[model samples]
Target: MQLKLAGLEDIEDVLTLHRKYQIDTILEEDKKDGFVTTNFTREQLTKLIQEEQGLFIARHEEAVMAYVMAASWQYWSVWPIFARMIADLPKLTFAGHTLSTENSYQYGPVCVDKAYRGSGLLEAIFEFAREKMSHRYPVLVTFINQINTRSYRAHTQKLGLVVLAEFEFNNNHYLELAYDTSKSLSLHQSTHGQH
Candidate 1:
């Protein structure tokens, strides 16, 4: 597999993988496994690539097997939930720093195709994204729906993200997670040359 920043050409394939596990359209049997709550569009993805350089992907056999989105609070502020998260940033702290828009960025809605779910792909791509974003941000933050036990476990267990807080939004409960970008997950080398 190849891990890299996604280009415009990757939008469709990324969306294809996204729809399979998106909250709105995911198969019922898949919900217990995990699902992405955010919905993105081609134009938004274009901005993510051109503006923030935050769309990361892993490709296997030329197909997008997993994708992770990270970007500044400004880019994400368009969404109400993210706006709320931004407002709460001053109240959150991680790795000896008071989290702020300047020192932190929103990360996630990571969607990994089921075929590649447990093959070390999640950790590899996650580190790939964290490594890339570390240049600009010292902290990475994300949220997982409380109902998404699979995602919460994968992130907290395999990735070691800290549960900083929990909040309710739009009647849904979520766990807020954060990590120090300077810390390495050490899985990048494991995915080498799989492309």
Candidate 2:
């Protein structure tokens, strides 16, 4: 198995993995069941694939076995820091961070193909992503709905990410965890050659 940054050709497999996780997250409720459903189309993936900001794929024998995607952006008051990141990962750095927007790296849509489940692929993906992201951005953050205990457990096991704040949306609260590159991932070694 090998880990690589995602590209246009890998969108389909990524999408399949994403949809499965999304359904798994919503299986217990009725309207709430299919409520989180997304009709995100192929065109959308095509567009995201072109951005190259935050996405990755783990391939086994040329097929995508797991994937993760996030958007790298800076919020208001972070212009200077954003500039530093741009200079660091110049080729893949984005000039898109805005002062009025919340500066953050949103990670998610990570899924490992079922057949390969429980094999520690998720931790592998996150460790790889954290090293790469920490090198590029100053911080990394992901939000897990308060009720999504399964995901919470998974993240803690892998990244040791824990609650930093809480957010209310649609009358539901989500646990927000923040990762300071220097603090959270300084000692982690890559599971692959990339690091």
lDDT of 2 by residue, 1-195 (tens): 888888787878776656655653434542232222223467656655676446778998757888776555432113343343333332221234321123446566466776775677877787677667766665566667666566676666556665655656567676666555554342543432222
Q: Kindly provide the TM-score of model 1 when superposed on the true structure, using C-alpha atoms.
A: 0.94
Q: Report the lDDT tens digits of candidate 1 across residue range 1-195.
A: 999999999999999999999989999999889999999999999999999999999988868999999999999999999999999999988999999999999999898999888889999899899999999999999999999999999998788788999999999999999988997886423333221
Clashing pairs in 1: 1-194, 1-195
**Candidate 1: lDDT of 32?**
89
The worst-scoring run of ten residues by lDDT in candidate 1 lies at 186-195
User: Cα RMSD (Å) per model?
Assistant: 3.9, 8.8
Q: Superpose all Cα atoms of candidate 2 onto the true structure and report the RMSD in Å to 1 decimal.
A: 8.8
Lowest summed lDDT over 10 consecutive residues: which window, candidate 2?
A: 92-101
Q: Please identify model 2 stretches exceeding 4 Å from their true place.
A: 24-39, 74-103, 183-195
Q: What C-alpha lDDT do the candidate models reach, one value each?
A: 0.92, 0.58
Clashing pairs in 2: 74-103, 75-103, 76-99
